[model samples]
Target: MIIGLHVQVTVNRPLGSTHPEHHTIQYPLNYGYVAGVIGGDGEPQDAYVLDVATPVRQQTGYVVAIIHRRDDNETKWVVAPKFRFVTEAEVRKATNFQEKYFQDDIWLL
Candidate 1:
């Protein structure tokens, strides 16, 4: 229920990096998860970090939107700085580097 609040995330996959296991997949942005907040995957909820242009180990930002996957059980949260409102189009473009394989919608808060 942190749909509109700022939360802490541990960046397991930083920007310009590849998945530890799926080496073919590359991360264009800071992709992480909220500790202790379990998702449908039975793990820490995964998130897509936005507005941050550089790689980081962790970050704190507002939960601006939820990327609900129609083809998968996983739902990713969209986090961005509180200073600006991120457009849905921007989210789609930023996450497309990886999310292109799945069907999703941006649920704005």
Candidate 2:
């Protein structure tokens, strides 16, 4: 993903939402999918919105990083404020709730 491109995310799972099947896993950040884009999983590309404090149904933001899953074909886009920055560790921690189930790498642009 480009570092500064404004992306529209359609949030299927908003912040504080629980996993559809894994009810115990709560989302700490807004989790969604890029509108009109299909991913390697043959579904809408998944995305995680960071640094934003409130719950949101949808949002537009710049791409900050890409969460590449080594074991799976799907890749998740990390979206955040244009001027904000998050370290690799921070990204890892934020997405760990679900990402921990897969081998992954965080690529910051």
Candidate 3:
């Protein structure tokens, strides 16, 4: 089935000057549709559910792709090897909107 953009990420918190995490990187800032699924319930087909917009790919097998970052100053795609789901957390300390929007859903890692 086709699902929405599964943004599997690991939020590395900010540390001391010497202990700063380099993974603050945003990498691919955007994602696109990969697949879709049939949505429905046991209520005599009340409606078709579009689970495709949900980020469920995190539970499925890993899909290999390339992440090309220029070494010098060139705009191109480079291969960084395959990646899989890890975790996702909203940035809190960096922005106050996280608390304003996410409200009780805000999570810090």
Candidate 4:
């Protein structure tokens, strides 16, 4: 339902950063959540930032897709810069770092 909405995502897990608990898992892209918005997990809405290579503190873009973890209850939003278009293949490749461990689907706009 949030697809096509523009939002600012606070990048808590920047690119190249290691997972807080799982050191073996690293972030290939910036990932964070939207402030004040609650998601299915009862926390800030989590998002995976796309279209950026370097580690950033935050990102402002449109919600391009959602990574729905079939086994898990959480859904990660995919955000991309203004005017930028993201494909399903790109989302898979960018989020494979962690999503690979779970059964998921790309919910596109």
Which candidate comes out best when scored by lDDT?
Answer: 4
Those runs of model 2 whose alpha carbons end farther than 4 Å from true positions after fitting are none
Model 2 Cα lDDT, one tens digit per residue, 56-89: 9888898888888999999999998564677999
In terms of TM-score, the best-performing candidate is: 4
Where is the poorest 10-residue window by lDDT in model 2? 1-10
lDDT tens string, model 1, 27-82? 98999999988998898999989888999999998898889999998999989867
Root-mean-square deviation per candidate: 1.4, 1.2, 17.7, 1.1
TM-score of each: 0.91, 0.92, 0.18, 0.93
Which regions of candidate 3 are displaced past 4 Å? 1-28, 38-81, 89-100, 103-109
In candidate 3, residue 19 scores what lDDT? 15
| C-alpha lDDT values of all predictions | 0.88, 0.88, 0.22, 0.90
Q: For candidate 1, give the lDDT.
A: 0.88
Q: In each prediction, how many residue pairs overlap at the backbone (N, C-alpha, C within less than 3 A)?
A: 0, 0, 6, 0
* lDDT of model 4, residue 6: 91
Clashes of 2: 0
| Model 1 stretches with alpha carbons more than 4 Å out | none
